[model samples]
Target: MDTHEAAGCAEGASRRSVLAAGALGAGALGMGALGIGALGGCAANDAGPAPAAGAAVGGHAPGDAPGRGRVLGPADAIPVGGGQVFVAEQVVVTRPAADTYHAFTAVCTHAGCLVANVSNGTINCACHGSSFDATTGGVVNPPAPAPLREVTVTVTDGQLVLA
Candidate 1:
């Protein structure tokens, strides 16, 4: 080829390479922006009322009430190594031992629906079959990726009260 034509062809190839690099850079930037948005969305939230053990399907914390809550005593109310659903307060209080108790929301974190059942040591949300560990409130399964909301529980005079 002629020297002039060869130089022109090299310039065209260089220009195309720069454009391709720019496109890749733009795509990477877009992905990074999306990742940032997702991180912000999941940043800690203190945005709402605390859920309770027996509040309802959608449990709310004792703080939601103007007056303090009425605590219920143990004394065989909760079966040993079993849980009791307080539908009124939307709380599930379980007694793993005579002195050890665990409390979490009765509602499924996925859809805000009442957990259908607690069986085999896991709380089951039938709405989507999402399961939360009854004692720890950890997600045992997906579809409901977030762990079940936990409540601060206090035992006063054998009565379990949300603190």
Candidate 2:
């Protein structure tokens, strides 16, 4: 082949190589960005303890009475030996005895997911499969390293009130 033609072929091959390298670099960067995004989502899920145990779970502290102490519902909404999760209030109220009741924050200590359900005397968190005792808020299953935060509650005028 002519020298000019050979030089042209070499130049075209070099251009193709450079473009391929650039595309590979861009693909690697995109994958790295995706990995970072996934990690960021996980980190957000594990941010911190939901709310303090002693107070209302969302935004009210224990003594933020005027703002936080809304009547949850009738005391009987919680069955004897079982509990009810109030997602709005972020509290779980359990009646372990005939006239006794207990309240705890619904936030899971492991990954900050709300405790989803109460069954068979246990409060279950769906996110990471953590279980807590309905009566005492103690951890029953692991992935959660701590007990749920306890909240003081009282029955007033047949309604459950956060204290």
lDDT of each: 0.55, 0.64
- lDDT for model 1 comes to 0.55
Clash totals for all models, in order?
A: 14, 0
Off by over 4 Å in 1: 1-68, 73-75
Query: What TM-score goes with each of the models?
Result: 0.55, 0.62
Over the stretch 18-131, how does candidate 1's per-residue lDDT look in tens digits? Answer: 345545666768445433222111101221222222332223332132213558556368776777766556567777778877877665566454555566787775545678
| Model 1 quality (TM-score) | 0.55
Ten contiguous residues minimizing lDDT sum, candidate 1: 38-47
Kindly report which residue stretches of model 2 are placed more than 4 angstroms away from their true locations once superposed: 1-67
